[model samples]
Target: MNKDVRASVKVGGQGQWSDHEKWLIEQGQQRIKTLMPEVYKTICRYAEKDSNVWRIVRLGLVGRPDQFWACEAGHVAGAPFTQFKRAVEVSRLIARFGCAHVCMIAGHGDLGGT
Candidate 1:
């Protein structure tokens, strides 16, 4: 399993997707599947066939982890690449895995921190 899928598995809710969100996730998933065949394979290796794991991964990037952000006591993992760096890493991971586009969308601040 890839880090994003693992991170996403940690979240909750049955991902009621809006049309736009669904479209984006599917687009990312398709791109990843085509561009980074290895990453997709990794995801397949890790995720449950019945679960919307890719959706969770996308949500993790676009939004915050529901569990972590839900509770006032919870916190984001203070990694050096939490935001943009992670996004870049994700992009690289996708490309390294032969993915065309990154699954995660990041902001400028997401790139600058750490």
Candidate 2:
């Protein structure tokens, strides 16, 4: 996280964070199950495809996304439980499988959508 946010996290008494620090980190990630409520669909689709355990998602910017997926999901990382091969993959899953819990505010996509 940035220096300012780190500085803002109020430390609990006696060097104990009491979970606030960890919670701040999780919230910064911005991925939650509510945004991708495809549990039933995923279960039903699993039998037909058997790719649930082998869901291949190709996120860019370095590391092998498909390789460390289990650990990543355990921590609830990028795009939550899904991965994006391209731009449309983001919206497609969000549309069909998504249940939606977005907060746009008075702005556009984060960081100008890069």
Candidate 3:
């Protein structure tokens, strides 16, 4: 885990995406499928099946979770990404699984800090 963070982060740099990043992306996909099925469906609807945004979502790019956050919070005034990044759900997910786990699930991993 440390190796992933140390070797692949933008500052030090692997100059390429890491295996761990790929795995976290996969885990995020599974989590969405299992835990946020409705959001998953909405993603399929809005982002559309197999579209570029959907593809990004699969890679853990923090895509549609933003929309979910907006809906749940009823705080639709700001950018969806802002809602997502600051939401309670995301905070907990990061605390539990590390930032890489959620970074791009719908959006960049933010140089990937915990």
Count clashes in each candidate, considering only residues at least 3 apart in sequence or on different chains.
7, 0, 12
The per-residue C-alpha lDDT of model 2 at residue 76 equals: 32
Q: Per-residue lDDT of 14-54 in model 3, one digit per residue for the tens?
A: 26545665555555556556665555555565464334444
Lowest-scoring 10 consecutive residues by lDDT in candidate 1? 67-76
Q: lDDT of all predictions, in order shown?
A: 0.39, 0.29, 0.39
Candidate 3, lDDT over the whole model: 0.39
lDDT of 2 by residue, 67-110 (tens): 21211222333233223233365457546865323321111223
Stretches of model 1 off by over 4 angstroms after superposition:
1-11, 48-52, 61-114
What TM-score would every model get versus the actual structure? 0.40, 0.21, 0.39
- In model 3, the Cα lDDT at residue 86 comes to 44
Error of 1 at 8 (Å): 13
Q: Which model is ahead, 1 or 3, in terms of TM-score?
A: 1
* Model 3 CA lDDT for position 2: 20
Q: Local error of candidate 1 at 69, Å?
A: 18
